[model samples]
Target: MRRRLRVLVTGAAGLVGAEVTARLAAAGHEVTALVHRTPVLVGNDGTPLEAAGVRCLTADVTRPRLGLSEADHEALAGGIDRIVHCAAITDFGRPEEDYQRVNVDGTAHVLELARAGGADLVHVGTAYVCGERDGLILETELDEGQRLANAYEASKLRAETLVHKARADGVRSAVVRPSIVVGDEHTGVVRDYKNIYVVLKLTTEGKVRSIPGQYEARLDLVPVDYVADVITQVTERFDEAAGRTFHAVGAPLTLRDFSDVMAEYPSFQVPRFVPPTSFDLGRLPREERVYYERVVALYESYFRRRMAFDASNTAQLVARPAPGGGQDFLRRLIDHCLESGYLGAPLPGVADVLARLDLTGADVSGPAANDANGAGR
Candidate 1:
């Protein structure tokens, strides 16, 4: 039998954090969900955490002692067995200072809390911390002297460095670095539609005509549920995962594969991929250029380089298989977006068009479709 541990999770309002909280609760673990502004501890389907017997606390990771009062700090210090530090600003457009304040400084504060509580730390970082380096990225690799794409990457790298330093100081720790997290594999339901969805939305809405990218560059995307599951497993088996790093990523899709999936939608404009070095943003019309500068410019590095993450450690630890990739999964995601009105209302007769194209399947839509694989809610 497994021990029922009292776990504290930070950033429980965000997508990955919320899912991790829910999964831990479902696994019969005592969970204390820490949030900043929003105190409502509800899952994606509006299920309250209290119903699952999970405790919710209002706190700030950027503050000393995580903004906990003397009584609360003593309680946590006495009872909390593990700390899952998932709180960090993930936006790319945020200023460098914001990234430093949240990702870097906030991490240090969390480390102090773990030190006080004598709790094992499970730090959630990003695979992009490897930065602009090419070839395979190992779980043990950090600070390869590679150029970062943005401040977000640089800040995450610094935060992971702090975790490593803490490990050396005798704080039992494990780091899980996930790539671009997307919707659930079976349900295709996502709390937020940012990152890759930004490009898909612009293209599907016919807002962008051309993009600067390499055709062969691969986009590493993983499902949020898979990431949460991996984290939970690591936390449960901390004795084995301590002082190690795991990559929670799956098979990546190339730019060509992405374009091919978009091509299936008749109304979607498949942007012509131009060499990043030769592509000029000034050549675009005013509206497109403005949108590119505001929304797409921050992710320019992702389209230009291909970075592969080696998840050998994660594979060895996780019993379940990783989520599937390729065009089939991409199609399911687009169909879910259209059905949920996330990508806006579907065009007239879009279902008929898909039927005529022979793209219909049992995994296309509805709750039954989502429940087929028992993967996600």
Candidate 2:
């Protein structure tokens, strides 16, 4: 018995935003998808949002009144009953001011729009706001004076603070923090591969072979669909969501599992893990040092942490459990990457390689024969 709501989804063109928009529209909610540059939104399954009765509006969240005409703003404010604030610059290593302007200030403007419309607000934040702290992270926790890992996390923390204050001031607001979002849980398909995918691409290519990490360190990866479903449920059941925080996260996979899964793929180069304290950039070759400094270093924090997020609050409200994650899930992600040609075609299997060799002239003791036999083994 969910009442149909007029929903305005900011960052509608983004990874999570796109899925959320599609789900809202499919669930019969009146959805207005706000985009800054890319007005066209394609769902993870390649379904176009425009065909689902979703109105795509070009608006900038960083601007006052969402960069809309005063009249248009008023009209939109009067029309929508819910605002799902999903817009933010998620790129790591960006200038601090870039995060400040987009993640922090943009939220302020969204808050204004929510207030003007007397709408319930659901703010999409990140679980990493728990910062560099290890062990269990509860939805109830926010600022524990924890040292943040990057500017992106810091900016999200500030934005979440704004939402909490707004809720206290009587604007019905809730926060949903999702851990690392990947592709569809079932299909392993994604709109765009960024974040951890970048690291995977580099590592699997043998560009950065050694990483500062621990085998037992955990990485929590959630599917985009699960994140979207939770948001949709929160919107449909605002009463249960208001004043609460939920962690939309899957089961964590240990670094050992990640390495083991990659090993299973013959085409993938399994990266060697070393203790962070013992690792030094100065000792690496010039080319490796440059790659590490520019790309790998940004995600180095994720490699060493062993934090686990508590999702009890999310379990109570969500209809289904978060997707299971481990070695198999990691394999699925890599398999999809290979299938989509993102990671390039996988190396030829042992049978294919053997069939291509002419046994009559093939020197069994030579480098080529030895290499092929080693690969098959």
Candidate 3:
């Protein structure tokens, strides 16, 4: 039997936070979900947090003492046993000031809350805090003189630095860095479809046909549930998790594999990969050039980096096996997109097309067959 403790989760309305909050409440813990503008907390699998007995408190992370009233703050400080700091601006290309205020300063405020409550802290960070680099990234490594790719990564690094400083000052803290978070492993259901999904939407819609990237660049995609699981485990087993870092990451897939998988879907348009050095956006069609410049260009770093996260600590602590990142999984993601109408209606399958052709007495042989097969590709 596990002891139920009072736990406070910031950003409870966000993806990972909601899942963590739901899990804690379901496990019989007294969970307080702190939210800002988005007060409704829904787990990754679409479970309402409140219905699971989660108490949602409206507050701003960017504000000191989490913008709570004095009485509320005192009550939280007195009763809370653990604080899971999940509030952070995760979007890329945000203004540096926004990142600093939300991610950096917000973390500082959360630390103060932890200090007041004498609560163990479980901070959610990103594996990309290792920055724009290749090869292996260890959990013990931070600030290896690698250049950061965006303001979001830089802000997370700074926030982690604060956590490390607090740990040195005797705050029981642990950092869990999750790589690119995606849908669930089995159902492929995601709460939100941002990040890589944006570029995926553009490419699959034929809005962007050519992208500048290396064929072998790797993308590490971890399931949202796994990340939440890691966070919840660390919170529950604080004694063993203190003063350590864990990577909640999944297996990685290469750009070639991604392209091949997209090509397998007859409704998906596979983007052509061109080396960054020789690629010129000016040569693209007008509409493609617009989409590339406005949307796809923002995600260029993700398409070029081949960074691998080493999750030795996570492997030791987490009992769940790492989720698969193969063709079938990719297909599952795409299938969900089609089913949810996120990608609009999918085109008819080859067999369906063949049946229609038979009814119309049209040829399904030679060049016509090849043309039908190559419709989306």
Candidate 4:
């Protein structure tokens, strides 16, 4: 019988990292979780992973050489056979160098650790690396003349490029690109703000009042569990995926449908979605109009277009799905948001929505502390 494998995971405290930790431990692998610091308590849904039979260690990717002492590095190298990297800062609003620091340089640091341990590397990358791709984004296509939307995409592309560079240098590496990460379909458990969740927060806060485009953009979301499952499968079945890139994405949802679904609460009004020509420039104060203009510009680029994902390679290799949910189910997810007080209050009109579906994010959205304010009620 094959002996249990020793695996090292960076960013084990993150959404993908935490789920990956649970899955790996459940699979009977000896898992070592790497993190930068010990928070008061990891939001169970937070970045630091929690699971049975896993050893948690301290390590920061952004530091020089991963911020580890020689002894700690040797201790990790002594038993680790594979390395999974999922600890990138996906904030689109950050500067270029910041993204490069975590996404590019941090990846290089992880590769260095993998080399030290003679372990195969699994690199977590973003599907947005496709960069303004319009349709049918394939798995094997990397340099397909796609332009990056922001620093986040550009830095991810650079990081993936570095992975390939390491492979050329005789390092075994696998690249996993997940698109527009959402809450777990089965659990609705996402730990932090990234991807489409930010839109919900900003919109619900009334920061994004009006959109000057058709609410017809495609927002492709993949669940954390599916991503974790696929990552584990790829690690176990590394040979089939070595030197390959995978696109783990779902079918896209239009912008109008997305907003409507997230606004199941009557208190949370659906903002007006107007065509550019229909926007009344004279109605808003000049500064407010400029703010709206910025919102319009940002959303127009990202959440406003139709995008197709061709996951044929990932499909053939991992043989799993990207957890599909239409706007109706998404409304029920909003019901969890209200009940959990993540939105600051309960939804007045969500009794019907709550009755029809299960809400999983309630546990995921509440704060990590055993305190009351963490989750709302």
Q: Sorted by lDDT, highest first, which candidate order results?
A: 2, 3, 1, 4
Per-residue lDDT of 233 in model 2? 90
RMSD of each: 10.2, 7.1, 7.3, 10.0
> Across residues 160-185, which tens digit of lDDT does each residue of candidate 2 receive?
99998887667898889999999888
Better of 2 and 4 by TM-score: 2
Pitting candidate 3 against candidate 4, the one with the higher TM-score is 3
Candidates 2 and 3 compared: the better one by TM-score is 2
CA shift at 221, candidate 2, in angstroms? 0.5
| Cα error, candidate 4, residue 169 (Å) | 1.5
Model 4 TM-score, all chains together: 0.81
Instruction: Report RMSD for candidate 2.
Output: 7.1
* Predicted structure 1, TM vs. truth: 0.89
Q: What does the lDDT come to for candidate 4? A: 0.71
Which pairs of residues clash in candidate 2, taking residues 3 or more apart in a chain or in different chains? none
Residue clash pairs of candidate 4: 12-49, 13-47, 13-48, 14-47, 215-256, 367-374
> Number of the top candidate by TM-score?
2
Q: Write the per-residue lDDT of candidate 3 for residues 65-99, one digit (tens) a residue.
A: 88988888878888889999999988776778999
Q: Report the Cα lDDT for residue 196, model 3.
A: 87
Query: What's the lDDT for residue 210 in model 1?
Result: 70
Backbone clash tally for model 4?
Answer: 6
